[model samples]
Target: MKPGTLRVWSQVHTWSSLASTAFLLILCLTGLPLIFHDEIDALGKAHKIEQWDEAQLVPLDHAVDVALAKRPGEVPIYLSFDEDRPVVNITSGRSADVPEAEMGFQPIDRRGAVAAGGGQTGGVTDFLLDLHKDLLLGQGGMYFIGLVGLLFVAATVSGIVLYAPFARKAGFAKVRRAKAPRIGWLDWHNLVGGVTLAWALVVGLTGTINTLADPITAWWRADALAHLTSGEGGAVQPYRSGLVQKAVANAMAKAPGMRPQFVAFPGSPFSSGDHYAVFLQGATPLTKKLLTPVMVDARTGEVDAIAPMPWYMKGLLLAQPLHFGDYGGLAMKLVWTLLDLAMIWLLGTGLYLWLGRIRKRAR
Candidate 1:
């Protein structure tokens, strides 16, 4: 790189890193626990359901009815089945458009109409996840975090550009321990940053993409839903029936070799006012994260359309598990944890070096 170009890249690296350092620190701290969120959640004593014959499983409609009986005046928003056990988890709220905070969740045994667990939400892990996701500021916070992720990416790229020149001068991974403290820290930062560059870039870019989830969903709904419901009338009509179970069955019949991951009731965000959107997933690990939506006519309980997610929506779906290292099982999560720790160290040392420079300038 030319001298002027190198100087510009150096300044870019410095400012971008400085701008996002604090938020990045918070993300690292919160994200570490979240990397093992499944394991941590497993630590809780779960209500065990005895194995039951699949043929004897209770109907989905019955399960929803049983769940709604517990929460009076509430309506079912979503119904999801457990892959490992004969249990159905139902989410209910005052209305379809109610806030998540107003929603209630219940796990019901499919073998028998039994409440498997108490309705609960908001725990330590959820708190950490919320903080890691959006700083608890909802949509606006997500946009802010997305901006920070962009800055982090900028820092990473600029650092890589600057590292080429530094490596040629100082040799790769050379930590000048005998030099001044700031110099030593700077050397350590460069070395560690270089070592973790690829992982950092992947996480930063995916995190940024993940932050656009709401808008992406909105776009998918606006475009895909419009296309799917074009002939049925532009406006969503009020659904007439409550054949939730039949709708799911119809969707499954339409999508052979796929299993229902979740069902979005009519008038819900994931469904039109006249259809039940049953999201299906494949049996494999990777495909489990990638969902296909099957829209069933709520009034007639017949298949309306089978809509595969758009490329961008699929990207968002795939990016989520990749961002969290959830697709590769425990081994990958361990690798993610170690990488997260290294990132924390890099952020800390970078901050230390920047402050040291500021102090010297003051003197």
Candidate 2:
């Protein structure tokens, strides 16, 4: 590369890295615990439900009834199943459009129709997730984080471009420990950064995609489900007979092989005002996160339409698990954790080198 072009790339690499270092550090720190959130969450549980026969499991209506009994005036917003156990988590609030903070979660045991655990809403993991995702600033914070992710990507690409020239003489992964501390740190940063380049790019890009989750969902609802959502009836009332259960069964019948992931009640963000949107998941690991919505009539319990996710929605769904290493099992999570640690080190070393240069210039 020409010296002028090299200088411009160098400046890009330096400024971009500097601009995103703090936010990247926050993400890396919060993300480490998140990679193992499932394991960490399991530690505090006082009750564990044993596996039960499918026939012995209680009806979905019964679980919703029990959950509603706990909060008399609240309406059911969502009903979700546990993948491994005979448990159903019911989310309720004053209305379908209730804020998440005001919602109540009850995990009912399907075998005995009893409350299994209190709730998984507020906790350290949730706090870390909120921080990592949007810095607790909601939609605006997500956009900011997305911009930071872009900066991080810029830094990574520029670093890769500059690496070839730097390593031409020193060779790859060569650390001159006998020289100045900054030189050694710079070499270490480049080596580690190179080793984790692909993984970093993947995570950065996916995370940026994840930041647009709300907008993507909104767009999907407006475009794909416009026909269903534009219906005349008002939101369905909760506990109005056995409509919820029937709608779920109808949804399951429509999609024979898939399992019910969650049910979005009428007037909720995931559903139309008069439809129960039952989100189903496939059996395979890759397809499990990619959900297909089966819209059922909340009032009549009839199958309205099966809405397949659009390409952008599918991309968002796929990006989420890949970003969190949730696609693979424990082994993948461990690998993600190691990469996160290396990223932290890379960011730290880069900051150190940049500060050293500034200090030397000052003198």
Candidate 3:
């Protein structure tokens, strides 16, 4: 390459890579184990085959009572249902609505037995996953990580656009000899960055989209759900949600084959005492992650079809797995993980190259 042209392209590569490398490194490192979170969770009592009374399920609140009993001092923060098993999750933490502390989690089965040892963490691994996604920052962390992911996507796109000039038959796979000063690092950059482009771009873009989710949810509430729930005065008063067990039962009745993924109880910013919205999760290759909400009259327990997610939600739902590489089978997942490592390598080398640039100028 000509000297002037080389300088220009070098600057392009440097600035673009530098702009996102630090955040990208954090993302790449944090995301590695998260890619295999299922494997890790599986190791920590994620599933089981236990006996249950198909005739009468332990009531939602009652099952929660079982979990709370199992962990005496803990508050029941979040309750999750089992898709196949008779497992019920009772998280012990202060309610976001009713302010508390220490969310201990327990799992209970159909016969009202807390599972032998469910919700046990793998310590460092669990911490890593949580930190990777949320930086131990809760909602604030999620949003901050999301912004980093967006910058990553921008870097990846600009990097790829510049690749057309750098790509060569050998360059695509090249690692130029140390005999050449600039050529070697340049070759390494193209090789590392090019090879991992698919994975990095995926993680970057998807994570970016995932970050946009909070805003998207707010938008959905403002745009789509508002129409579905008109003239309700926005559930401002925190009404003590009554008969949650019944509301859950009614939600199940409404979404027969579908599954209840989550619930927005009364007094929740999402719902109020007058109504409850149960998100019915879909089951399909593509639709599984998509949520279909069913609203119930909290007092009367009538189920109403909740409005569809806006275009943004749909995009987010799809983008998440593509970015996380969670949908595909084991082999594909492995490929995604390997690529995740590659992204880490790219970020590392990209950082070193930029540092080298700065030091040379300083010299």
What TM-score would each prediction reach against the true structure? 0.94, 0.92, 0.80
Instruction: Itemize residue pairs with steric clashes in candidate 2.
Output: none
Per residue, candidate 2 scores C-alpha lDDT tens digits across 206-231 of 99999998899888878887765564
Candidate 3's clash total is 6
Q: For this target, which candidate reaches the highest lDDT against the unseen true structure?
A: 2
Which tens-of-lDDT digit does each residue in 219-311 have in candidate 3?
776666666666464443232334557767777776667777766654443554356677777677655687776667766667755665667
Tell me the lDDT of model 3 at 248: 73
Clashes of 1: 0
lDDT of each: 0.86, 0.88, 0.67
How badly does each model clash, as a count of residue pairs? 0, 0, 6
Mark the 10 consecutive residues where model 3 has the least summed lDDT. Answer: 233-242
Q: Candidate 1 overall Cα lDDT vs. reference?
A: 0.86
Tens-digit lDDT track of model 1 for 115-209: 98644567789999889989999989989999999999999999989889778877899978887877778878889899999889989999999
Off by over 4 Å in 2: 44-49, 177-180, 227-239
- Which is the winner by TM-score between candidate 1 and candidate 2? 1
Best by TM-score: 1
Where is the poorest 10-residue window by lDDT in model 1? 233-242
